[model samples]
Target: MNAFMKVQNLHKIYGDKVVLNKINFDLKEGEFLSVLGPSGCGKTTLLKLLIGIESQTSGKILLKGNDISQLNSSKRNMGIVFQNYALFPNMTVLQNIEYALKFHETYKKDARKIALEVLEQVGLTEHMNKRVDRLSGGQQQRIAIARTLALKPDVILFDEPLSALDAANRLTMRQEIKRIQKEYHSTIIYITHDQEEAFTMSDRIMVMSEGHVEQLDTPLNIYNHPKNDFVNDFVVKHLQTKLNDLEKCMVKDYD
Candidate 1:
């Protein structure tokens, strides 16, 4: 597939300090690409730049061969689902989902219909009448995703969306998100520090460090053939440790 979105020679600078250093990547349509890295690795900064919240010091952000790096956030036609869920607590799920659609000319006329459709897409139709604050974490997250879907964005960006959930809820939401992506035919850029989360959900994983991409490839290839010490130590070794711990627990259970 052709590159649906491209970030080339991207750089972000705050005074004398550089936050992102000549970063580059290509994203395909309807692909789930996870940006995996530890905290303060410039992953969040990259998201902000792509979404137009932050301007790149230098570089081009091309969407379908058009430069959109300078566009305002609202004009970018990209949706973001934050870790906090960022819903209106007092509003019902239906209202929260309908809120953003009012700003879109094409969707505003049929806001309720679109909202309900997205709510059903995320499997939160039954909770539509409930206040967002009254729902559990997982339900609230689905609402947030449903709200984003209502606008019918070209690309969806997730900023460590499941990091706030408990283990059970996180696992459940993972499946929900993958289903939504497939059914909605969305292109997603998921940001996460969890190796397992990236491995399970992403079509390809982009490993980053200190504002640079360490490796960008399939999860299996990254695991089997690491490009350098950082990729091996950060991604491979960490996943291996988790597997070793799981093996010990399984052996104990059998004994």
Candidate 2:
């Protein structure tokens, strides 16, 4: 597993308040890493910094071993899917996907071809000609994903991408996103507050508190072996009560 993205001593501040403090992590190629935390825990801020939407106050970001801290959003070759889907209301499904490729200039002549292919990948080929507003929320989200995929970016950042959907829709989209990432072999950084979603979708989960990373590990370890009291209380919400005799004896001793 090659390191596709790296963050070193990442820090962000607003006025006199620090939002992120000396954060560090590395994402492997073709890996799906989820940032999970409560609201205002800097999960979204970390995603923004990865995609170049927000600059870090200090530290470095490396993409494929190249420093990208100073690179503009478009130059970073990263795609981002926002929580709201961010589809172009005036453009058809095909046109929306093609927009990302327009930066290549040659895309103008072959936009439809590229767009249709991406739409088909996301199971939206039948809706290629339909206006974005005509599609359902789930369909629009697929369109947004297709548009980002069309760019063939090195990394994709998802900023609570499924937060807007209903329970059923969220479940459906979660599977779709997993499928798309596997098919494309794309490195994905997904941010979410939903523990179930993180557990189900992430190759690994990074648990954040306030502005710092408490633990970064596989989902099972994160749930069963949290690093501190905060992680224990915040991340691990439930545990099995099937105690063995020894454990029951320990409880009796405490009592």
Candidate 3:
């Protein structure tokens, strides 16, 4: 299968500091790839580069074999959902979603139709005419997602999108996101520090640390056979106590 997106030796620098270092990866069409990392690990920076919000200091980004390294943000054909929802306070829920489709010359009327459908998918159709300020955090997050979907972009990049919601709402939204992505058959690059969220939502997970990718594999493989001490420590730190104890027993067999 052809890769829908590819990053080759990507590097990003902010003056004297490096934000991303020699990053390389690829996403197949309809794949859900979660980038798992702690804060300040450059995961968000990677998302920004993919969407053209930030430029890479070196290397190339290819979307379906077209180099998009110098493409304008608006031309990237990628949708992004930020942690803060990024909704316009004055716009109604439906209007906010419709805004994303304004640039698509062929889809003006269809945009509204699609936006409404996405709102319904997110359980926010009743809130369509309501201003963003009136909605709860979860509701606003759903609006953000709906807005992104309205663009019908080739790829979706989510930057810690569920971080601002409560636990219950986060869980609900996580499942909704998974379902929506599959429904659209969209390639997704999701960034989150939450291990459980990554494991639950990702078809594959890339563990990043200190501006580099430490490992990329299926969640089960990441948990069972971490490549290095850092990954092993992270797995132990994040796993439940029972699971941690089980890992110890499993490790003994390897010893």
lDDT of 3 by residue, 1-255 (tens): 667888999999999999999999988999999999889999989988888888899999999989999999888889889999888999899889988677688778688788888888888989899999998998898888888888778998899999888889999999889889878898899999988899889999999999999999999899888989877777545776656788999999999
Residue pairs with backbone atoms closer than 3 Å in model 2 (clashes): none
By lDDT, the best candidate is 1
Q: Which of candidates 1 and 2 reaches a greater lDDT?
A: 1
Per-residue lDDT for 56-121 in model 2, tens only? 999999988899998998889898999998888998888788876876764667777888888878
lDDT for each residue of candidate 1 in 1-255, tens digit (9 for 90 to 100): 559999999999989988899999999999999999999999999999999998999999999888999999998889999999999999999999999888788998999999988887778888889999999999999998988888888899999999999999999999999999999899999999999999999999999999999999999999999999999999999999999999999999999
Please identify model 2 stretches exceeding 4 Å from their true place. Answer: 238-255
lDDT of 3 at 69: 94
Worst 10 residues of 3 by lDDT: 234-243
State the C-alpha lDDT per candidate.
Answer: 0.94, 0.88, 0.88
